[model samples]
Target: MQSTLSGRGFRPGDVHTLIVPLFHVTGLNTIMPTAFHQGATLVVTAQQSPRDILALIERHCATTFFAVPTTMILLAQTPGVEQHDVSSLRLIAYSGAPMPLRAIQRLRELFPGVRLHNFFGLTETTSVTTVLPDEQALVRPESVGLPPPGIELKIVDDHGDPLPANAIGELLVKGPSVVKSYHNRPEASAEVIVDGWLHTGDTASLDEEGYLFLQGRKKERVIVAGENVYPVEVENVLTRHPAVAEVAVIGRPHAILGEVVKALSCCDPTPTLTSGR
Candidate 1:
């Protein structure tokens, strides 16, 4: 946690505002410890309201803030957001889910001076394995950034063969932070951890610079006409539409194709379905 924050320019005497639930891994492992290690003030709230969060940032002069993409979207779109004083914030990091490019652009516009970070990791890894810094957030909006020091990451095919750059495969990670096994659940742990490497279950690809880009979860892939469709890829495209508030893509059974992509979206008014193909 300290390494994650320090690498991102967190300093002593900074203030961090956290709205994520303490029961979640992000709250327990990442935010709290990071703040404590940096000697920074930590302000936490049980509320998930965007308005309240904005207010907290101003009231506490929060220098660092972390939240999920959904929360960031809400905060960006919430009414009277501009009325709140968030000038104190210097860093804003998001994780736990895929963030739409629109939301990222919105944040950049709202907080031009603030640095944006995209963090990627799981509970087993003890917080973050990769961090997409503000410098690259806009240039490579889809990447989850490069891995930190002391961590080893790889993309491997089903047969455990290592894949080259840009080849989509299961993301495997090994490092000091990775937990060896789940307490008293050896069988369950075995399914994910093999040879000291934790199978993240996330299908991803690495660029030539070793920056990881998530495709989607292995279980979330839909095979349509023997072609795999990653839900996140479809969701990212659908979210580009102005009418879409949020979206989820899934596979529906199709007699001929085996499965077909189905998108469900939340919008202000009913959207007219149009087929380009």
Candidate 2:
């Protein structure tokens, strides 16, 4: 059988370690299908420990591991991670959430030979929509890369008018991968899927080269005095600091600005947002 998965560079019969939950789209729709299509072996472990996962990768000589940012950070910062021979890992794909630039650099340090890929998609999109290649991973760390084959992506304004390149707007996707509707909720299905395009509800932009950049969710945008502020951008910058472990930016009520950026953060030992800077 011919494979439509051409752009992806996984070996013909490589081994993969399933880090994400099997019920999740990353594992269910993406990893499982890919492994079956490529005729590769998949390593599954009940316990989700850094040590156990790493050990399995070594035992299976897994060439690929698909996980989110937190798992990536934990695996990289695992106690005595060097003790595990994860040199077999060639491709590290991350999705679900934003991978801070600092973490990306750490991954590079931990696995020099591996190619890091940032994937962007929702459960509604089935799995992956665009992929930031290793070549441009560092160069455009924020970008989620261009669409894969058989997918059509575009940015549109509030009126559903298509926006030009680099203009931030709602990202709409049209392709075979997109679901026709929700199981029973016709109202929800109608609201989200309009005119054959899936309104992703994500505030994003496409660059001149067709690279996709996701700012955040449209409803999550914090407008401070008529200026748009994306929480993810602020969160990315916050995570760059050594002390910060996690951060969540939100839009809070403000009398003047309509909304203001409110960042809730946590750090190991203690957290002082002002002191570190």
Q: Candidate 1's residue-wise lDDT over 1-277, tens digit each?
A: 6567655677889898887788888888877787788688989887688888888899999998988888998877777777988999999989988887878998988888999999898889988889998999878888889888878999998899999999988999999899999999989899999999999999999999999999998998999999888888888787778778789999999999999999998874655645751
What's the TM-score of each model vs. the native? 0.92, 0.91
> Residues 1-277, candidate 2, lDDT per residue (tens digit)?
1222544566678888877888988788877888898788987666568788888888889998877888887876676878889888899888888877777888898889899988888899888788888999899998888788888999999899999998889999988888999999999999999988999999999999999999899988888989888888788788777778889999999998898888898785564557538
Candidate 1 lDDT (Cα, whole model)? Answer: 0.87
Number of backbone collisions per candidate: 0, 0
Stretches > 4 Å off in candidate 1: 268-277
Q: For model 2, which pairs clash?
A: none
Would you list the C-alpha lDDT of every candidate in the order shown?
0.87, 0.84
TM-score of 1: 0.92
